[model samples]
Target: MYVATKGGERAIEAAHQWLAEERRGDRDVPELSIAQIREQMSLAVNRVMAEGSLYDPDLAALAIKQARGDLIEAIFLIRAYRTTLPRFGASLPVETGEMAITRRVSATFKDVPGGQVLGPTFDYTHRLLDFKLAAEGTTPEAQRKSADETPAPHILDLLDRDGLMEPLETSEDTPSDLTREPLEMPADRPLRLQALARGDEGFVLSLAYSTQRGYGRTHAFVGELRIGTCAVEMEIPELGFAVEIGEVELSECETVNQFTGSKTEPAQFTRGYGLVFGQNERKSISMSLVDRALRWEELGEDNTGAPAQDAEFVLYHCDNIQATGFLEHIKLPHYVDFQSELELIRRLRREAGAEEREAAE
Candidate 1:
């Protein structure tokens, strides 16, 4: 049982008021508008949306501002708000093949069907800070081009045609809603994917890194990485047809791993998949590696005793909100619990001393 402390209502209220003042900062400086945050700090907003499991950019920006640029706090705020909203009908699975491509690349093949579109990336840029940005310099507008009507084909499809890659099994079963359902052990692929999609970026990235370092090494190659807007459709029961709802920017990564085969099965390249909100390629790639690592059991591979391969460890600790809650709660009053521990230790020491004295006597 936990002990409760009372009579800090005034102090708590005063602290909250002070916190508000601190959040506002200097009155002389102009306040950051929600639009500015939504546009300029888009990556931060994307992180909040991904982790919070909410897709509203406006609310995400608002949460970021309210949290004073603390992304985790912002995520916590967005998640709290998300819980209060009513659930509408779910949308049909997005057709990524039909995505209006912004950026697409393949490491497995030099030249793909659509070719490589660099888009806006920091890959080639030097790490040095641009002083011009500090002076409020404006960049020239980028050259515009006509939208390509041809749909960019998935790289996996090329491998699939030759039977080089493992064929994905289709499922008519509706995936469990992780938010609503209690996370059970030996979770299905759908549930694991859901968890990884919203898992802490740092934690997931570390696990992925571990795999690369030979901890649970899966010789993985980036088959394709794409970023684009995909149309979401919802089937209205009355219309008996699916209608376009809205578009969401997504980053998808498909990794081709080393071939896995048995005497009964043909050798085929294993695959890992990751799809995340916004232009978050890093998270997408990392998620894919971790996802692949977690699939050791399904793939009939040995459990290498790696952190990423342990479903319980990954699923239990990957949630930043849950992690912070438990960690931050330690600051609360635990006087009763501490006192009990203190008494027990002291009593044991006293008993030891008494026993020693008796022996000496």
Candidate 2:
């Protein structure tokens, strides 16, 4: 029997040093500064923040640099860091409608209230390789617009005013947090949103696109996608009222989908909602579509058994960190199990071959 080589302690220490050196890269090349990473590699930072369930862009940028821009590794860093932080009490839900607008756009409306401010988006930019970025040259920063002083009520709320849409109920129940608790089956909306917020962007996007292609089809329009800060208030039990704990920038998307009324009910527009960390408009929109699709049961629609319509399917598969980690970890030393399988298969084949020869004779 070949003995397995063992140098656990020394090897582990050596790996740590090597990782540090590799993360730093060539000493002469000059390191990519954290501020540079935060400003320039912000999209990568956004993904880490989104998946890691933490909103600190600077920390995310540092993690990205430390992980050599491998996003999964960066996510792991943030997750690890998040585990160390003390748990603060849950904050009161911020009225997202009152968010200090940074980026707001609605594709469905030509000119809506707060007037369609498309702040810092690459939507209209031609998809071309910019050679300047390879050498770090001057590219004009995305133009920013000052927001309007007074924002109007949500577009869907306007529909509600005319009795064309279903209005949201004022639920006073506290929402669940997925991070602290183990994800239970038959999750509530808060848990679903929490899962979707940290979900893989590509996976959620594909799920959203699937709904558009008629798998649990629902007519959806971007009612609004807004990115900005909302004051996170907390209920101080001693104070008998909620007080502002902190503020967080969030991306909120609301979609108006065509509604189907039951025999006793009048037809009204149904809506889907998504609110997530940071400036993730695409994720927010995708989440809204996915959210609506998951609500087929609540809406009294026939379950077509589509993957998007299946809460277990969408919720379980949405997170890249969980999916990637579990999928890729199989590459690690699984030799013991592999050898057992190999022996079992070999024995089975040998027995089958003997049986075949006897039968032929």
Candidate 3:
């Protein structure tokens, strides 16, 4: 039970005031505009949107500014604001297969149907930090290319033609929203994917690394990784057909895992898929690895007692907001609780001393 502390309201208010001032440090420096953060620190904004489960870049930038660049705190702010917003109808699933070609690569194949396009990647860049960026007014230009009219075919589709990859089962059932419903154990693929989509990047990456290290290993190969913008569409109630809403940038990773033939099923390559908001290749790849690890039961693979293989452990702990709330709460006012524990210990000592005195007498 938590007891309300007396005469601390003023102190709390003062602390909050000081925090606000600290958030705006050095008044002499030029203030950071929302646009600046939205354009320049785009990766941070993307991460905030992904983990916060909100897509508004303006709001994310504002939250980041308010939180003094603390991404986790910014996510908390966005999530809190998200709860107050009215629910709109869900958009139809965006088709990644039709994504405008930006950065597309295949690890399994030398040359895919559409040639590999290396779009705005740091894959070949040196690790050295360029000090020139520190100076103001640096305008960099990238080579332009004509937009391809044709939609790049998915690598998985190519494998499917050969009957080498496992066929995906289509479902007309509406997937449950993890945001709306309490996470129940033994979650389905859709629900688990939802959680992982918004899960902590570091946590997911670490779990994925564990799998690669022989813990619940799936011998996964990156079938394809694509980063591009896809059109989002929503169905109107009055109009029976879906209309284009807007476009959102996404990074998608598809992993081809080795699967030996089971008695009931023929030998074929299984898949793990990850699609996330923005061009976050690391998170997307990590998400795919963890997603595959969690499929041990359904894939007829043995559970290697790995944390990633345990759905309950992964789902319960993946949420950064929930994890931080519990962790940060320890620093709160526990004076009353601590005093109670102190009194109990004192009473127990007193009783033991009394017993000892009586025996001596």
Candidate 4:
């Protein structure tokens, strides 16, 4: 059996210094600017903001730089920094209906009122690599018409108007923040949605995909997907009115799901909702699917034993920070434990050899 190594603080410090140098790469190249990262890597910044539950692009960009381009680390940094800031007050729930939409699409209806506005999407791109981009060549901007001034109404509202979709009741209850409180089982819809909104995007996406692949099919149809800026309002008691605090970019998705009515009620379409920090349709759509799957019990549907349907499982393992911490902790010193195992194995081998020799004699 062997003992653990002695202290290595000096070695740890040297390793960190080496890591810093490696992070910088070639000193001859100009260092990446925060502005460049904010603009060029805006998707990464959006992910940090969404996962961190803080909507400051500048801070997210700075975190991205400090994290050496690790998105999860950037999210962790933003989440840590957010806790240090003072809480002024809570803003009023955003009015998504009044959003100045930049992008809007619906799979259910091709041409609805306020036609499909395919703005700044890669959906139609041929995916061909352009060699010119490597040399800093610029492509001419696509032709565009003036944006419609009127706010585009959500397409799901039409189905709601006709009583075809599930009725959504508005409530004034404050939502519980998962970050502030300990996560408990049997989470409510608001709590589940909150967990999903900030959950690891890829993890949630995988679970959502599982649902679509007949693990717990919801037969979801994209009723509407919208990306836009909406004003955040805060009610001021002294002012006796609500005032616009600021604007935040958001992606909202509404999914129309199939629901055969139980013996007590008539058949109707159900709704699955998703709202995220920025123009992230993939995350939003996936969130909606997962949200619907988790609602199986409430909807009077039988549990299909799907991973996404398990609220406790999904919520507990969704945070990348927590997952990464536990995973990386395996790399920590376990020399004593391994040494004990090694000694036991050696003793067992020696005993088996002696037993064989005696049998031969």
Question: In model 3, where do residues sit more than 4 Å from their true spots?
Answer: 1-7, 146-149, 351-361
TM-score of 4: 0.93
- TM-scores of all candidate predictions against the true structure: 0.96, 0.92, 0.94, 0.93
1-361, model 2: which lDDT tens digit per residue?
2347599789989999998998888899978999999987767788789899998999999899888888888898898899999975877668888888888878677777667777878899898998888998787865565554355457677778889887785678877777777787898777888898898888999989999999875679998888888888889889999988677778899998987687655788788888878878888899999988988887788888778898888898887778888999998777788888989999999999999999999
Pairs with steric clashes in candidate 1: none
| Alpha carbon lDDT at 331, candidate 4 | 97
Model 2: ten consecutive residues of lowest lDDT: 144-153
Pull out the clashing pairs in model 2. Answer: none
Model 4: per-residue Cα lDDT over 203-292, one tens digit each: 999998998899885789999999888999999999999999889999999999998987765799998889999888899999999999
State the local distance difference test value for candidate 3.
0.90
lDDT of each: 0.90, 0.83, 0.90, 0.89
Question: Stretches of candidate 2 above 4 Å error?
Answer: 134-144, 147-151, 238-240
Per-candidate clash tally: 0, 0, 0, 0
Worst 10 residues of 4 by lDDT: 1-10
TM-score of 3: 0.94
List model 3 lDDT by residue over 118-146, tens digit each.
Answer: 88788899989888877866677768675
How well is each residue in 284-351 modelled by candidate 1, as lDDT tens digits? 99999998999887777889899989999999999999999999999988888899899999999999
Best by TM-score: 1
